[model samples]
Target chain A: MSSAPVHAPASNDVIATIRDKALWIRRRSFQMVYEAQLGHPGGDFSAADILATLFFGVLRYDPERPDDPGRDRFVMSKGHCTGAFYSVLAAAGFFSESELSTYMQPLSRLNGHPNRNYLAGVETNTGPLGHGLPVATGIAIAGQIDAAGFRTFVLTGDGELQEGSNWEAALTAGHRRLENLTLIIDRNRLQQGARTEETASLDPLDDKWRAFGWQVEVVDGHDHAQLLEVLSASPRGRGRPLCVIANTFKGKGVSFMHDNVAWHHGVPNKEQYEQAMAELV
Target chain B: MSAAVSVESGFFDCRDSFASTIEALAAADERIVTVVSDSVGSSKLNGFRSKFPERMVNVGIAEQTLVAVGAGLANGGKVPFVSAASCFITGRALEQVKADIVYTNVNVKLIGQSSGVAYGELGPTHHSIEDMAWLRLLNNLTLIVPADPWQTEHAIRAAAAIDGPVFVRVSRMPVPALEHAGAFEVGKAEVLFEGDDAAIIANGTMVHRALAAAKSLAGEGIRARVVNMATVNPLDEAAILSAARTGAIVTVEEHSVRGGLGGAVAEVVTAHDPVPMRIMGFPGFLPTGSAEWLMEHFGLTAAAIADAVRQTISRKR
Candidate 1:
């Protein structure tokens, strides 16, 4: 069932509305992971604000007409963070928020990763890293061919960029001058096993993207004002795609979980869950 | 549909049919965009490029992006036809094929050119002998190896018509186009020649050889049936079972016997109709040689196939 209109709230109150929505997303993500006993809560929290802002304030999508040809396209490349993705979609009126309870249940569409066929708003199914950007580049190219003014956005985990496929697509996107595409990197330092730097450093990540011909932007991911401003802007490069590095904290809003490597995909126990909910409140 | 110039000659490159058919289809449907991995010359897609420059995209030596981008294009409502060499397209970007194309179930066409030993003497590094085995394991993907130009053109058209992920293989090596009765349909096999003594099941370049072997077997009073299995996945189990009734089978392919046509036939036969079978293919890696030399070296000739059929039939008795 539809939740609410996806249009941005009054301009002055947009940030506050998105901030409250981000908190709700975090709570819903925690409950989903807690009930399912499975999911990457850390990643979900890290991307909560970015997802909430995109769904609520920036993205040009109609929940009632999910398949509208001229609507904006979004690909959640950081598929492990599907809890946050699903929660935001639920809040955006794609489906009922109550479905979150069925998060990792048998045969549930809310899988460990986002699947386009299973959900209305998911642009493509992605679990493996480095896939979404290339697909987004292709989508942007299609828009260019059809002269379709719709923009394409893809969210990728910082660590996921380590996959060579992302660079391959980046090189092509830059060469094609895909002005209609925007790639958002969820720059939460932590990965599944360790910090991203410890696993495989992506430091100077913006420089790397710039070298590949992308118009790079580094933004405070949790700031709703900053997110809405950066995301709503038109393509910056004359002929190149845009890359927005969204610096965020893992397990955000949860005191014990934030930036803690142990919380990567860790499901909190009963006491930990209550404490997380308390912190979110 | 009758712009067709039939070639009933000595040998015809299947890539010719592939390029011509794709160009014609692209002319009709703007959704049919061609993406290549620096393989326009080898894939014989230059004409299509010249005609539809806007639709031709070259990812330049990157097979991973070739498929990933194709998946994305499909996501945006365009039917992408990815043309690349089989060895790199299937080996280098295998995960993209699995995750982006197959797992997502997008409408992308993967045309693997110069498959098998078509890149002759280029050594094992370029041989796509493992393509069938590797691609077969992935779900929601259709695998087709067109034996000649007629079949190749029809297969390309069939793949374009289908709505999901499809892999069509074409070879640089030319072979006489075989005349078959019905139109080419996905997951369907055609009986080229019929006999009761034994069945010679083959695909790709080996179909012609299998037909010649059946003729040789008939000369010796040992009649052999010949079946051309163009589609490997969603195999025509009914035709396979019917061939099994012969009590003997000789499977031939230009791939490793472990998981190509032979492996598929064996799996089906043993489960429903167990019979004496001989799988003929490159048992292992071979020294660099010409395509003809390598085919003969691996016992892929009609004479060798006939000998194997004789052995298989003898074992059945």
Candidate 2:
């Protein structure tokens, strides 16, 4: 179930639609991971709301014209967490919802990581950490050079910032004043096995972006209203790239897995799956 | 016989050819963009930066971002040439090169400047002798190691025309302009000279020296054929198999003896038609010396190649 992609201040209707999609995303993504017995469900659930907000409301893309030069771009930098990504993409009509069953199966296009060549809405191939932002920066630079109307957005994991490549790209994007680009850091605290603060701290992250010449905005990542408000805002005359620090929990929807690092790479057991699905709403 | 050995038809650095060709390409194609890592001066792109200031995207000395940005530019439909010191681009930011450019299958042109031991006295830290070995592993990536200025120009143009990832290894080392009547193709090996006794397959800065080696070998009554194989990833199998027909193959390059042009040639010759092969190049991290001195010290000269070809011929079945 997909809403018409919108770009206005979040009305109650739009917020409800995003919340519905987000819940669906959380439920469907976990189901895929549970069936496959493979995926970063913690990261996926953490990023589900953001992905739902983007695909259903903020991002302007025609699933039929996925390769349209003028279409807005969303690069999932935290690519290992494809449970949420593939769900949002399917819901947005990039592919059929039934195809989720083939995810991570033999010869499936729905791979553990996203590949642009194989998947319609996937902008670039990403699995290795810290790769998405630089690529997004390059796309933004390309848009700026052409004076194109399409904006570029990238959602990166908090721990993924440990990679220096992101900062390298951040410097370039900020220096170029690429106002058309928006970087959304999924500040969910937990990484794979430990909290990001414990595993190479990334606090004072907003200050770091500011020093790199980016405008910073902190928001409740799961708040459809907050995500829509910041993301849909105009970049006109902004003169700089925007960095949205989306504060969230690792496993946002499920009670037992919420903010839990052990669930980062673990799949749900049959009973756990049913319980999580029940809690998703 | 020493570091003083010179190219027959005057000397030229392929980096000059690379710069001029990109400038010419950018003039015609509006989508052509250059992404460098504060390497405008090193890559000899000052003229290009001056002409098309906006098109020259200097990512400020970050090799990883330099390569990834090129991939992005390609995503944005601009043909981006990601240029940087060969050692850093291929080694320091290798994952980005693999994930962003190759695995992503983008049309990003990676111009690896001063490849091999062109850094000379700067030591192994800056030497990119392992680039071919590393890059040749990635599929869907066009690997071109131009022999001289002309081939360097042709390779750059060809890489631009192709709609995928390409790594054009350029050298600051002086080499002569080669004479060729046929057009340059991406995967075809150019037979500079033909002989039935033995073959010397070479590329990059070593092609000219291979020709010189072939000349001296002829005087000594040894007719050694010379094949300039610039494309490493998709080796010219037909040409290499034909060279293997000579019974003895001497693969020479301005790279590591383990896995560069020499190693690539051996792969074909061994699998299809086993032959006595002598892979000639540097051993590993070289001693402090000038570019020419190191080439001489490592036996990457015409005399050494000819000697190796002669030695390889003795083991012919």
* Local distance difference test values of all predictions, in order: 0.88, 0.91
Per-residue C-alpha lDDT of model 2 across residues B1-317, encoded as one tens digit per residue? 01222344488878888888899999999999999898999999998999999999998989999998998998898999999999999999999999989998999999999998888999999999999999999979999998878888889999999999999999999887788748899999989987999999999989989999999999978999999898987888999999999999999888888888888887887789699999998999888889999999889899999999989999999
Residue-wise C-alpha lDDT for candidate 2, range A58-141, written one tens digit per residue = 888989999889899999999999999999999899999999999899999999999999999999999999999999999999
True contacts kept of each: 0.76, 0.90
Native-to-model Cα distance after best TM-score fit, residue A25 in candidate 2, in Å: 0.6
Q: B267-305, model 1: which lDDT tens digit per residue? A: 999898599999998876768999889999889999999
Number of the top lDDT candidate? 2
* Residue B104 local lDDT, model 2: 87
Worst 10 residues of 1 chain A by lDDT: A1-10
Off by over 4 Å in 1: A1-10, B1-9
